[model samples]
Target: MRTQVRVVSRWIGDEQGVTSIEYALLAAMFSVAVLGSVVTLKGSLGDAYEAVATAVTLAVTTAMALVS
Candidate 1:
């Protein structure tokens, strides 16, 4: 029918929803980037904590040896 054809054409040409769709895509991309950064930093942070812990243990043992 002509009415249905016109409706479909109008829907296809409509720009009202474009901004919303673009924003949704932008948000999705930002979330992915943040998640990736967090995952990468997780490993680095663990390594740093381990290094600090080892340093503290060494310092404590040295102090104890000097005291004794």
Candidate 2:
């Protein structure tokens, strides 16, 4: 019974494994947040580019019609 108590106490004091698990969880959460933001920004930039392209095309067409 004494040996069992000593073993349990030693295991409780050991903390290397717990610290590594906590670091891994924090890194995973940070990576997920960064990836989500990149996806949202990419979609917004694509829409803005398309809108600018359409506006330029319309202006060119109108100017050509007036000149002809």
Candidate 3:
């Protein structure tokens, strides 16, 4: 019974495993934040690209008309 108690106490005192777990949790949280940002910005980025494409198409059409 004393040996079992000692082992448990020693395990509880050891912090290496705890530190690793904390780092893993931190990384997971950072990954979640990055993924959320990307998802939220996806629609905005798509809309901006579409707007730029439309403007370029219009400019090209206007230039071609002037040339003709």
Candidate 4:
């Protein structure tokens, strides 16, 4: 009974795994932030690409009409 109690006390006071748990939590938080940024940037980049495509199409149509 005494040995069991001593083991339990030692386990409760152990700090060996604390740093790994903290690092895991920090990594999860950083990943969430990065994912959020990427999602936002994805939408903005799509919009920019669409605008450029529309501009190019307009210019090509105008040039073709002039040629015809």
Candidate 5:
């Protein structure tokens, strides 16, 4: 019974896995932050890209008109 108690105490006192757990938590938080940012900016990014595409298309059309 004494040996079992000592083993249990030692196991409870072990710190080897603490760092790994902490790193995992940090990684999870970072992932959540990135995901949230992407979600929040999804519409804005789409609008920006669409505006750029429209501008490029208009420039190309104007250039072609000038060339012709």
Candidate 6:
């Protein structure tokens, strides 16, 4: 009976699964951060491109008017 109790106690004290669970949680957090940044940066880059496109169009129209 004592040996059985010791075996059960040892089993309860083992921590092999804890590290794996912690690493999994950390990976999930990193994935979320990376995904969120890519989405936000994509939006910002699109806005910047639109602004540059508008400026270029205006400049070209003005140049054509001056030439005419």
Instruction: Identify the candidate with maximal lDDT.
Output: 3
Clashing pairs in 2: none
What local lDDT score does residue 53 receive in model 3, on the 0 to 100 scale? 100
**Candidate 5: residue 32 Cα off by (Å):** 0.5
Question: TM-score for every candidate vs. truth?
Answer: 0.50, 0.58, 0.58, 0.54, 0.77, 0.57
lDDT of 2 by residue, 1-68 (tens): 99999999999999999999999999999999999998979989899999999999999999999999
Model 3 bad stretches (over 4 Å): 1-6, 50-68
TM-score of 2: 0.58
Candidate 4, residue 54: the lDDT equals 100
TM-score of 6: 0.57
List candidate 2 segments past 4 Å from native.
45-68
Please provide, for model 6 over 3-65, each residue's C-alpha lDDT reduced to its tens digit, 9 standing for 90 to 100.
Answer: 999999999998888888999999999999999998989989899999999999999999999
Candidate 2 weakest lDDT stretch, 10 residues: 38-47
Give a tens-digit lDDT track for model 4, residues 1-68.
99999999999999879988999999999999999999989989899999999999999999999999
Number of backbone-clashing residue pairs for each candidate, in the order shown: 0, 0, 0, 0, 0, 0
lDDT tens per residue, model 3, 1-68? 99999999999999999999999999999999999999999999999999999999999999999999
- Give candidate 1 regions above 4 Å deviation: 1-14, 49-68
Best of the candidates, TM-score: 5
Task: Give the least accurate 10-residue stretch of model 1, judged by summed lDDT.
Answer: 14-23
lDDT of every predicted structure (CA atoms): 0.97, 0.97, 0.99, 0.96, 0.98, 0.96
For every candidate in turn, the CA RMSD to the true structure comes to: 4.8, 6.1, 3.5, 4.6, 2.4, 5.3
